[model samples]
Target: MSNFWKRAISGFLFVIILTGCIFLHPICFFVLFFIINIVGLYEFSKMARRMEIYINLPIYLFCGSLLFTAGFLDAYIGYRDGYLWCFLATFVMSIWELYRKKVNSFQNLAFSYYGLLYLSLPFTLLIYLPYMTSDEWRPEIVFFPFLLVWFNDTFAYLFGSRFGKHKLFPRISPKKSWEGAIGGGICTIGAALFIAPYLEGLTVYNNIIIACIVVFFGIYGDLLESMFKRNIEIKDSGSIMPGHGGVLDRFDAVLFVIPAIFVYLEFVY
Candidate 1:
C-alpha cells in the first residue's frame, strides 16, 4: 500500500478507537489510555537506551504506570491517596540505584524520573480533563483539545509548506514558520466558535480561549518532542503506528496541550 493509504487507514483506526473508547464507557477510556501510557513509557525507555542513557527500566515503567493509574483512581473513584505510591517510588528509585552501581547514578535517576514527570504526568492530567467542567464523565469535554489540535496541525502544515518564509524555531524545527502558525491559529479559533455549541454548557468565549491555548501550547509540545528526537538523532519515537510513528509521536501536542487546558479550565470554572 502507498504511504498515504497506510496513514489514512491507521489514522482512521486511531480516531475511531479513541472516540469509541471515550464515548463507549469510562472504563473503556481508562483501559485504552492505560495501555497508551505503558506504550509511551516503553518507547521512551527504548530511546534512552539507544544513547547508552541507562535507566532502571523496570522501575521507570512501574512508576510511570503508577502515576497514570493513580490519577485514574483519583478521578474515577474520588480517592486521594492513589498518588502516595507514586511519591514513594522516587525514594525507592534512589535506593535501588545504590546496589547496581551504574555509571553516573545521578543522571540515571534524573532521566528515570524525567520520564515520569514529562510523559506520565501529562497523560494523568488528561484523565482529569472531563471532570474540569462537569462532575460526570463527559467524552465531549475530554475530546475538545483533540479537535482543535488536529485542526491547527493540518492547517499549519498546509500553510507552512506553501507560504512559509520565516522560521518559527530554526534550531529545532526549521520547517515551521510564523505564517503557518498564524494561519493555523486563525482556523482553529474559527473551529472553536463552531465547537462551542456542541459542548453543551461552555460559551463561545471560553471555547475561543481554549482554541488559543491549544494553538500556542500545542506548538510548544511539538517543538519539545522535536528537540528530544533531534537530541537523540532519531527520526521517529517508534514504529508502533506505521505511518503515524509511535503513540508519543502522534500525541506529543496532546500531552503538552492537556496540562495547559486542564489549568485553564480549572481557573476559569
Candidate 2:
C-alpha cells in the first residue's frame, strides 16, 4: 500500500485503540500506558546508545517503572510519600556509575535521568489528570486534552501542506509554517468551544484557554522531537507504529501538553 493509506490505517487504529482504552476502565488505562511507558523508555535508551551515551538500561527501566507505579497508585488511592522514595531511587544510577568506572559514566547517568524526566514524568502526570477533575475516574476529563492535541495536529498538517509559505522554524522543522500554526490554533480553539457543552466542569472559556495552551506548547513539543531526530540524524524515533513512529514521536505533543494542562487545572480549580 501507499504511504498515505498506510498512515491512514495506522492512525485510525491508533485512535480507536486509544479511545477504547481511555474510556473502557481505569485498569485498562493504567495497563496500556504502563506498557507505553516501558516502550518509550526503551526507545530513548536505544537513541542514547546510538549517540554513544551508555545508559544503564536495567536500572533506568526499573526506576522508570517504579515512578509510573507510584504515580498510578497515588492517583488511584491517594497521595503518598512513596513517590519520593522512587524519585530518590533514580539517583542510584549515579552511584552505580561511580562503581562501574566507565569512561562516560557521568554522561550515562545524565541521559538516564533525562529519559525519566522527559518521558516518564509527563506520563505520570497524565495519570493524575482525571483524578484532578473528579474524585472518580472520568474518561471525558482524560480525553479532553488529547482531543485538542489531535485537532491541532490534524489542522496544522493540513494547513501547512496546503498553504505553507513562511517557515515557523526552518532549521528545526522545515515543513512547519506560521500559517499552519495559526490555522491549527484557530481550529483547535473552535473545537474546544464546540465541545465545551459536552464536558462537565470545564466552561467554554476554560476550554478555549486549554486549547490555546495545547496548540502553543504542542507545536514546541513537535519541534523538540524533531530536534531530537535531527540531532540523532534519524528519520523516525522508532518503527513500532508504522507510518507514525514510536511512542515518543506519537505522544510528544501529549507529553508536553499534559503538564501544562495539569498546572492550569490546578490553578483554576
Candidate 3:
C-alpha cells in the first residue's frame, strides 16, 4: 500500500483510540498515554544515540517511569508533591551520571533532560488535564486541546503547502511559513469560540482566551522541536509513524502547549 494509505489507517486507529478514551473513562486515556510515553522516550533516547550522544538509558527509563507515576498521582490526587519529586529524582539521576566517569558528557545528559521537558512533561500535562475535576466538562477539557492542535496542524500544512511564501524560521524549519501559522491560529481560535459554549460551564470569553493561548504556545512548541531536529541534522526524530515521522514530530506542539494550558486553567479557573 501507499504511504498515504498507511498513514490514513494509522491516524484513523489513533483517533479512534483517543475518542474511545474520552468517551470510556480517564483510566483508558491514561493507559494509552503511558504506553505512548514509553515508546516515545525510547525513540528519543535512540535518536540521541544516533547523534553520537549517549546517556545512561536505564537511568533515563527509571526517570521516565517516575514521571509517569507522579503524573498519574498529580492527576488524580491533586498531588503537588509529584512534580516536586519528579525534579528531585531527575536531579539525583543527573548527579549520579556525573559521578560515573565513564560518561562525562554534560551535553548528552543535558539533551536527555531536554527531551524529558519537551516530550514527557507536556504529555503528562495532557494526561493530567482531564482529571483536574469531577465535572462533566472533564471530557471536553481533555478532548478540545487535542482537537484544536490537530485542526491547527492540518490546516497549517494544507494552507502552507499551497501558498506559503514568508518563512517563519528558515534555519529551524524551512517549510514553515508565518502565513500558515497565522492562518492555522485563526482557524483554531475560531473553532474554540464556536465550541466553547458547549463546554459544561466555561464562559465563551474564557474559552476564547484559552484557545488563543493553546494556539500560540502550540506554534512555539512546534518551532522548538524543529530546532531540535535541526540541531541533530535529521529530517525527522524517528520513523515510527510513516508520514508523521516520529512521536516528537507528531507531538512537538502538544509538548509546549499542554503545560501552558494546564497553568492557564489553574490560574484562570
Candidate 1 has its poorest 10 consecutive residues by lDDT at 45-54
| lDDT, candidate 2, 1-269, per-residue tens | 98899889999998998899999998898898899999999999998888888888888998898898899888888867768878688777678888876677778988898899888898888887777767888899888888999999999989999989999999999989999999999999999999999988778888988999999889999999899989999988888888889998999999899889989989987
Model 1, 1-269: lDDT tens per residue? Answer: 99999999999999999989988998998899889988988888888887777888888888888889899899989987879998898778888999977787777888888888778998899888888778888889888888899999999999998999999999999999999999999999999998788896577888998899999999999999999999989989998887889988999999889889888888887
**Native-to-model Cα distance after best TM-score fit, residue 259 in candidate 2, in Å:** 0.7
Error of 2 at 198 (Å): 0.8
Which regions of candidate 2 deviate over 4 angstroms?
79-81
TM-score between candidate 1 and the true structure = 0.96
Candidate 1 runs further than 4 Å off: none
State the lDDT of candidate 3 residue by residue for 1-269, as single tens digits: 89899899888877888788776876787787787787778788877786777867777777776787787776666576876777887888788776777553786788779768766877777766655444332777788888889989988888798879999888878889988888888888899888976876567876787778777888888888787777777888877778678778877887777888888777765
TM-score of each: 0.96, 0.96, 0.89
TM-score-based ranking, best first? 2, 1, 3
Q: Which prediction has more favorable TM-score, 1 or 3?
A: 1
